[model samples]
Target: MPITDEIKKTLTDPTPLYALAGAGDLAYEKLREVPGKVEALAADRQGAQEMATAKLHEAQGLLAGAPAKVTEAVTALPTDLKVLQERAQGFALQQVARAVELAVRAKETYDELAERGKVVVDKARPQADSTQADAAQAVEPSDAAEPVAEPADPAEPIEAELLDEPPAPKKSKPRKSAPGVTE
Candidate 1:
């Protein structure tokens, strides 16, 4: 088909409209449960505040000791330039290793969350499809016009490729530290 005809067909298609209506219905249904959820969260606010306060104090304690630790490390530095260079190189290597580890962890976390989100959407898909079917049936032509095509199978998801799991990230080798330096 020509681009214009394809665009026109897409614009005229009722499937998207039904899908939108279905999404709206789902949002409305979820919104109905919000008030109860809000009340429950409000009831737990005191406990949350207490927990936050405890964490804040713990952080403050850690911060208070940080300066002393830094001073101690500085004072403990060896007088020899060669030894200092090795330690500095080891520290740099350790930082690089830490960065790699964190990056790996972040990728893993993102993939995990993506999988979880897909599962949630999959669970909601049937309800949305049912709603779309209901909406399509409820709508009727007001005047004689081109007959609308029958709705596609509601059980079939929109994009199969999009639903495919993403490839896992490649694992990197750990950095080797300088001699006599701990990880």
Candidate 2:
């Protein structure tokens, strides 16, 4: 008769069709439960994202205030300029040595960071170049492509002009050979 009556009849009958009907009903019930489950998962993900964003903002705020906090702490320390200068003078030599060491270390650190940055930039350069080339290709007509102006060479040497005055006279030096070393 109707589809519902047919399904009911098939469910009641002792046949493979009856098992199929039961399975279909179970599948339908599962399908009905899916929206609620998906909504719950989405809400959980949204809440996690919001929490992460809040924590990121808090960390940024703290980092932004760090310099001011450091300044305040340094100013609060109980030491006058004259006393500090005298104390510094007492350890002047040691301080100079330490300063030299720190300078060398900072130079090494800067060199390492520069090298790493160069490598990263080198890796990205080809991709950026290709993207620019693609854009250029898209914009230019095929017939005019051959005549497209080439980029000026970046390593062109500067033209030197002659100076009006002659260079200063070189000073003479008295040279002596080392006793044990040959030159």
Q: After superposition, which runs of candidate 2 have C-alpha atoms over 4 Å from their true positions?
A: 1-90, 144-183
Q: Pick the candidate with the highest TM-score.
A: 1
Give the backbone clash total of model 1.
0
After the best TM-score superposition of candidate 1, give how far the Cα of residue 34 lies from its true spot, in angstroms. Answer: 16
Q: Which stretches of candidate 1 lie over 4 Å from their true place?
A: 1-75, 141-183
Worst 10 residues of 2 by lDDT: 156-165
Q: Cα lDDT for residue 80, model 1?
A: 98
lDDT of 2 by residue, 1-183 (tens): 699999998777544433344455556778999999999988799788999999999999999999999999998876788987877797998889999999999777555555555555567779999999999988885984566334377475433322445778999897888899877
lDDT of 2 at 93: 81
